[model samples]
Target: MTGVVRLRAVDIEDLRVVSALLQDAIIPIADMAFLPDAQQFVMLASRFQWEGRAPEDGPTPDDGAEAATRINCAVHFSGVTAVRRRGVDLRQRGAFLSLLALEPSEGALLLRLSGGADIRLEGGAIECRLSDRGDPWPVPARPDHGLD
Candidate 1:
């Protein structure tokens, strides 16, 4: 069902699918937390679309149909992870989490974050699930200003 996306595979394609879901999402930093001690990065995000459209190509939140398709997502990546953040402060609130790129490296999944930073997780075993909540994804008060 489109309303509920369950992905449990630990494969390259799985990572890509998860990446696609998170593409162009404006995730709050408070909704994300990285536990270096546990080697896990957990995030709750409101993903506008998982159709893999470019940010500019995706429907605006004003588009009622597409906006209703938005899903609240949860992503979890674990296994001997290492994080390197560049040009993004963990202190930032309501930051946009642009998944710049995803690829296979050293037998692991490499997540290229926006601002030239990256996170490498030990297996491609990233888990992502999605569901449409009672309400649609909230549009920012200012156009495009939601980006951090």
Candidate 2:
């Protein structure tokens, strides 16, 4: 995938793919929106390029021969009947959060973020799309979870 990344998710399995790609993505508070009239929830994230990473490269960029890359991506979920935010301060426009996962719980889609923050969407069905908005750039380091 040399060009822009585009993905669609209509089910849990497909969402797993999108979730994996967006893991560790950085999202600014000001970049999120919930359009009630449109029944949509959208957010822009600076996502780490995890697709091409080699298994032998280990975790950090320092352990690999290639530098880590990041790109801006826009994600949207349609058919969102309701949205609930927790542990997120919408007033903190400058604050950012790291994406942890996207999972289904009790028929709702949950966007797990760092610092125990979360945004949950409830609706009839899950329809999510992610598209890269700009060129990818090399990042100095990869996100470390201390799992090693």
Best by TM-score: 2
Q: Please state the error at residue 50 of candidate 2 in Å.
A: 0.4
Global Cα RMSD, each model: 6.0, 2.5
lDDT of 2 by residue, 24-127 (tens): 99999999999999999999999988775454647633465567889999999998989998999899999998999998877789999988989999998869
Looking at model 1, residue 12 earns an lDDT score of 66
TM-score of each: 0.63, 0.91
Top candidate on lDDT is 2
The lDDT values for all models are 0.58, 0.89
Candidate no. 1 TM-score: 0.63
Residue 36 CA displacement from its true place in model 1, Å:
3.2
Q: List pairs with backbone clashes in candidate 1.
A: none
Lowest lDDT block of 10, candidate 1:
60-69
